[model samples]
Target: MYAFKKSLSMGFDQAVEHVVEELKKEGFGVLTDIDVAATMKAKLNVEGRPYRILGACNPPLAHRGLGLDPDLGILMPCNVVVREEEDGSIAVVFMNVATVTGLSSAEGMKELGEDAAAKLQKVHDAL
Candidate 1:
């Protein structure tokens, strides 16, 4: 509904690496990589499975979106999450740009969102 999800039969680190590579191929870059598991353990003294939140961005598309609506910056970079499941499988999830962008009232936001979603779909299909 709000995201595209896939389960990977690979190591946690490997899955993250693969997802990053695929994003790059789709003209997306990893702007930030947050290791949620480690952060939680250090900041809250809680243990958890391996989990990472990747902030991905496509510079050209971001520029266009900004030109259309400055406030769209709130959703600038997309998110791709890679987390280890209790079943020992890795899960890779991608933000559904179309769903999020639909919230905007900008004139061309829908088309822009569809374009971005297609690119992400390519990455999803690749993996």
Candidate 2:
């Protein structure tokens, strides 16, 4: 699977903040925050539900991945998505590091992927 998902029983803005806090507890930081809905509205003049794509990174883990393969930088930061459901509920989705890292054959990459995935799972469970 490309991602893990969870429903959040909170307001959209609150859920976004909560996800960021949970990620920090796991040593991850939000490096980039893309407001998809707002961007679409500004660029394409389209209407849509609230959605955001957060680029999350753990500096230590990213450093390790880079040391293994410089090209791995392309996949360094994982993406987490926060969006509102049609029913007005909030949902958050986390990137599956294992699935993405499996594309590389670098030594110890599998273990690294598993480690990151476990940490993300903890954040998922925290919600």
Candidate 3:
């Protein structure tokens, strides 16, 4: 699958905090955070579920990837999503790093991807 997902037994706000902390522990820093629900409400006057998209990056890993392939910027920061389900549960989802960076033909990029994926898996396992 393209994503690694897990349900968090906590409120939306709490889940977001926990996910961020876990990511940080895994050497990732949140570069961007988009509040999808609020954005949709403001821009289109439409209501949506509580959803957030976090663009996370490990500078060291990202640097390595760039050195291998400058074009790696296309997948620079990995995306982690936190959303509240209709059942009142929250779910955390992160993209599969190995699968994403696998698109690159650059050597050693896959190893970097594997390292990243391992860290992210740790983050998920922590939850």
Candidate 4:
């Protein structure tokens, strides 16, 4: 299994909305939204199931992580996902903050990642 997976059962749109709300509660904001399903359909003329990628960021946490290690920005914001399963269930998933930010060597960044991971886990659990 990949290091960055957490799943919650919900409708696709509802899952996305819930994640956005939960992330906001954790002081993070959705900065980017890419509708994989729509994009693939439009760009590649390929039909696929529903999927989306959300880029979330918390400014204070980002600042803290960057302060610890400049290069940590490469893994900043973390990615959250929403996809429809074959069984007609929606699964919302997010990057494991600890795993993704662990790529950095800065201890402070690691700590920040751990904190963020806790918040994200809480959000997932709430879902």
Candidate 5:
């Protein structure tokens, strides 16, 4: 799969909070948050799941990647998602960093992706 996912037993909000703390412990910070359900409702008038996309970044790794290729910003922050399932449980997911970052031609990006993927794996495991 292109992502690492875990079924969480906690409520949606609590799962989001737990994910943030776990990511912090792994030296990552959430740089952005996209509320998908809200966006879909406002833009398309469609009902959707309780979904949030979190842009998580490890600054040192990002800096290294950017230094190799300025255009790497497209792949800078990794993505973590918290979405409510039909069963009312939350699913915490992380994009497979190496897979997504593979689109970059940055010199050191492969290693950076590996390192970033490792951290994200830890975050997923913590859930």
Candidate 6:
């Protein structure tokens, strides 16, 4: 699959809360929240399913990556998402942190990304 998925028994709000809590434990802080459902409705006048994009970041890791490669800001703030399935289940997912790091081609970025990926995986696993 192109994405990582974790199903949760909790409702949408509760699932999001759990994700936030878990992310914090992993040293990630949410920097942005994009409510795709609401944005699409307001911008395009079209209706769609529920979806959200959360921009997450670990300041120390980000700083290290930036110090190694000055242009790494393009990949800063990892993304996490939460959405409702058709069957009323909630699914939480995130970008593979290691994958983004690999895109940098910087010497130390791979290891940094791998460590971030491991933490993100734990967040998903907790859900």
lDDT of 2 at 112: 86
Give all candidates' CA lDDT scores.
0.94, 0.93, 0.94, 0.82, 0.88, 0.86
Quote each prediction's TM-score.
0.98, 0.98, 0.98, 0.90, 0.93, 0.93
Q: Output the better candidate (2/5) by lDDT.
A: 2
Q: What global local distance difference test value does model 3 have?
A: 0.94
Task: List the pairs of residues colliding in candidate 2.
Answer: none
Runs in model 4 lying further than 4 Å from the true structure: 1-9
Query: Cα RMSD to native, each candidate?
Result: 0.6, 0.6, 0.6, 1.6, 1.2, 1.4
* Residue 50, model 4: Cα distance from true site in angstroms: 1.1
Q: By summed lDDT, which 10 consecutive residues of candidate 4 come out lowest?
A: 1-10
Q: Judged by lDDT against the true structure, how good is candidate 4?
A: 0.82
Model 5, range 76-124, lDDT digits (tens) per residue? 5888999999999999888998887788876777887898899899888
Q: What lDDT would candidate 2 get against the real structure? A: 0.93
lDDT tens per residue, model 1, 8-126? 99999999999999999999999999999999999999999999999999999898888888999898689999999999999999999999899899999999999999999999999
Model 3 clash count equals 0
After aligning candidate 6 to the native by TM-score, how far in Å is the CA of 79 from where it should be? 0.2
Which window of 10 residues has the lowest lDDT sum in candidate 1?
68-77
Q: Which window of 10 residues has the lowest lDDT sum in candidate 3?
A: 1-10
